[model samples]
Target: MSDLRDPAPYDALLLLSFGGPEGPDDVVPFLENVTRGRGIPKERLKEVGQHYFLFGGVSPINDQNRALLEVLRKDFAEHGLDLPVHWGNRNWAPYLTDTLREMTDAGHRRIAVLATSAYASYSGCRQYRENLADALATLEAEGRRLPRVDKLRHYFNHPGFVRPMIDGVLASLADLPEDVRAGAHLAFTTHSIPTSAADASGPAAEHGDGGAYVRQHLDVARTVAEAVAHETGVEHPWELVYQSRSGAPHIPWLEPDICDHLESLHAAGAPAAVMVPIGFVSDHMEVLYDLDTEATAKAAELGLPVRRSATVGADPRFAAAVRDLLLERAASERGIPAERCALGALGPSHDLCPVGCCPARAARPAAAGADSPYA
Candidate 1:
């Protein structure tokens, strides 16, 4: 595992993500991109856009991604890994197609992509692959050559990601009133998807149908909770909960939205609670709106003290993790036994998705040369 590639094989690293609006004017259009396929009316979208408007129509995701890009660039340079890094999004300016075209034009033939999402659900995993397919098709239509893109393995269990959540939990615990902190329960939160989609996620294994998604999140939450308890000597009870549900009411997604859980905890006489967003890589709109605004307000109204841990953004450890992943992929490509890091032990994600992994309704034929791992 200590053996490293003499020279990195990757020519570039692409940071792929779901883009967000940068200002009040961009909110409606951003929502449109998110809901393009869904037949939801414009009026309903406007109402939803109000969430972004509340925060000056800016999504922290893009900025966070930019910060991550800079961190990766600096880390790579420091390590003498001369790979140039680029950023692209599914929607908004600097679209994936344009970014890929730029990279191709710049003469990058072999590239690696690191998606912002860290889980195995359809939207989290498969959709990114589909987007890559679409981008490649767009490039072909424009008579442009597409580069070979390989996605990094998911890093949910990596110390770089998980340790930050544990640190966040400890900080949140310290912010609470002393007595309340002692009695605080921990609630690990993630975005909710339809139960069916969760069931169809990842390769079949002994862990159950949606094993990949569910097990990854559970492990992250448990690891953070255990580390926090060990560090602070607080035997806080914890549970995983869902947030930012947007589907039809009757269709069940993940259970116990953060607000509802807070109310229940309050009614059950829990003095305070801390929410750790184990399913997210950064504090995007969902984290800002759901946890910071909605859940906090609910807890306040119910006389329950609540605190949310910070998302991993530009953490040095995370930068190191990304570097390690690239090295592992490069070594594997060279027929070397890939060294197992805390993150790499999760195993390399599928370069080409397995049949029926993360099945989507109205599934379209996958475009050729899609670089997404899910594809």
Candidate 2:
């Protein structure tokens, strides 16, 4: 049973995200957490930590999550939704386990999680589920009654999520010189996962060669591009690109890195370009360093005009979308027919991830899915 205003069956909403370093001292440790199982050396991690140091050793993700929490709370209040929103990160302070323990201590038995990642991939979806399982296991070890957790469907194509990106692209295009505005090419970018992982993303059947990761990004890019053309009356040439690639150089990941893509565009004599980060929910380290600092520098060197569009960070519309998602899922859980809103080719993603969805390299327990052990 559920209360319409309270979203019963779900007493709390957890905002889960990939945490980042808050200061110079936290950088190496944060990186260690991110690459725990990987046997990368500490020196290499410190070298990688230069990106954080460049930005005063602070990752914008934590603050962005804080702002998002504030907006989600405000939006919930305004809309009469009574669910309390809590923030947690997989790798940093206010960690997922601690937050879940806090929720349990407060007597929340049913919880809904909204990961900051918008698309489906091993890291994006299943890893978070695994973390949830880990947290629940820890609670069980401590003799706490673990809560049942459900993850919200992927919102990459949700109108609330897509619309802000569209507006951002429009704004970036407007910022370009009038001469190049009509001819500017749109580069839709996302984080580059290993090719094998991308091949295995989403449900086992639905995702084909490139898997759901690539397919989802392409869908968002096409939808946004088509909308931009419809509004501006110029069909700007666009292609899905990848950024923020990490891991062994020998291992293949998504290709045409944004910097390399920029070089290509410059060589091809494109007047200008706009980078649309459809992959990230907010302007985190990847968006800031990979695109803004690194790729922007590359574009500058190539004498190419480029503007990085904004991510949907704490946008009121996104907050409203979150509210809509919580309500929609709540109704569905109660076996009531609820309007599932989505834009673009892909309809709403599955409410619960199927077994074998986004399989990890080594199988681990995951919560909030059909394969979740907690259930």
Candidate 3:
């Protein structure tokens, strides 16, 4: 597959995602891995486990990651990008540390990480970096060769990611009752983190705000909603709302939850609604439980029609976008000019995160940052 085009600089591509339990027996342990160091009691763990219990104790994320991994492999093959593709999770089997050990043993020196998250936030960006840091630290303790890993830029406004969401929302609008389509409300949904986390997301600006997370979502929401209106002629009213809030009640998070947003639409005489999971890369447990089950149940009780649009799960365009980003990063490493593609207010985020970006509640080494000692 080699040609005049320069070969990819990285030896491997790692698909980093949040992991989930595979079966009934795996639930508690998986959650323990997720909430490690946070001193939640067994009862609280069981309470949260109920969400998985309702789903037969299986989280769909691993299977979804498998599907995405295959799609990425296929995309790499078709595009003649010969780099090996590997998948690992932060909190389950095929864990990031294990994956890193195997990758280095297989003789891969440099790796490119493509996190499932497409936005900027601690969990979305820094937390993943911290995971990488943890994994790398463990590997170093065992005296393994630490590879240079560069996370790809955020894709919140990437044409490929946003385009599929636009298509999904348009299809959802069309699914509504024809008479109510024009009056339908588009509720763009994403996970809600604590208000403190929200305020500290992205780089800590002197202005003291978390603009990137909210701003990027809103920009993408506007772009998609306007396109959906233009293409479907629905003129749907839309707002960026949040879902999957897990924090304590007193701790504030992004406001106007999806269910609440649905109720507001119903009370305002809106006849139907569409949920665009703009915050997620795929329809994982959050999208399934929150939007499919919980929010749908709420809409049913209100007698309001609702349709949930698909996330950009292994969509060909998104896969292509990954290829484009990889090639661009490879070119940049070689000092070659490569185009950076994005569609909304914020342009492409920096390939290398600067220090002081997305500070955790406390200090820890993070991945893909200026202070990433990995290099």
Candidate 4:
């Protein structure tokens, strides 16, 4: 592999992410920002916002992102890669537009982005691109030049990403009571999207229409389960589950909610379960509330031992993986031999998304710098 320090004239690395409320006062408004066009009542949002309130109305995502930024900076310096990293959130202060302006003011002409999401669906991918476009538009309106930005491919199947979660699952299993560990079932979980959106995910042809979300989650789960079995000499069964469904009741979303799956597992004579949040990078709102609170309560009702695995927040392996991904992309751009890893037989994602990839029903404009294989 080419050294990460190869002289490529990229200006900076942007850590793009879904922002969360930082305090009790920001909760309702932040939720409002997230659900703006959905027309959900504030009272209803308050009910949902209780999850944030449970932990002093703060989300762990921002701190996690900060830690990742530091790791990237330190690793880049150690590897002789000279670049500044700036962070911008999709729905909060230090917003994307402002971040872009700062980068422009600092004389950055070319940028590479690493979105927090690691999948190929619209929300997970394209929407961030669209958000980038919107942010650029705002910057252009303010008479600032927009830097050309490229996003890295999805790292979902990268060993740096997957291996840490495998370790997390094993650790969680070990923490459970011995009796519980004996009967534990692995539940792999992710966000729930509407069936239509899910079906339309990924590039046209080959992958077929939709279902990318489920397929990706399954791939991660199976890989982790296999690794767990290999490391512990235990053959634990696993199931794919969904959480964080925010769509209307009239709209059908992903099935077998984590709680529901836990109930079914208990009924099937399983003594305990370990939840692997395969879909997320950290224990944000969904993992903290849906899994820790809701799913644990359900398991308590069924007298089943339940433990949740940790997210890959600031794991050194994950940080190293990010470093490798940047190096890999740079090498590929230069026509060098680049090492690519992927889940199952899905292969590598496209470097540039094709027209009409992961089409949205109520189509939003594509974001600037949104084009990538993962998106």
Highest-scoring model, lDDT: 2
Give the better candidate number (1 or 2) by TM-score: 2
lDDT of 3 by residue, 104-184 (tens): 889998898999999888889999999999999998999987888889989888899999999898788778888888888
Give the Å shift of residue 89 in candidate 4: 0.3
The digit string of per-residue lDDT tens for model 4 on 19-47 reads 99899999999889887788999999999
Candidate 1: misplaced stretches above 4 Å?
1-7, 206-210, 343-352, 365-375
Residues 122-161, candidate 2: write the lDDT tens digits.
Answer: 9999999999999999999999998999999999999999
Off by over 4 Å in 4: 1-4, 206-210, 368-375
Give the total clashing residue pairs for model 4.
Answer: 7
lDDT of each: 0.80, 0.93, 0.87, 0.81
Q: Which runs in model 2 stand beyond 4 Å of their true positions?
A: 1-6
Number of colliding residue pairs in each model: 1, 0, 0, 7
TM-score of 4: 0.94
Ranking of models by TM-score: 2, 3, 4, 1
Residue 128 local lDDT, model 3? 95
TM-score of each model, paired residue for residue: 0.93, 0.98, 0.97, 0.94
| Residue 103 miss distance in model 2 (angstroms) | 0.5
Shift of residue 80 alpha carbon in model 4, Å: 1.8
TM-score, predicted candidate 1 vs. hidden true structure = 0.93
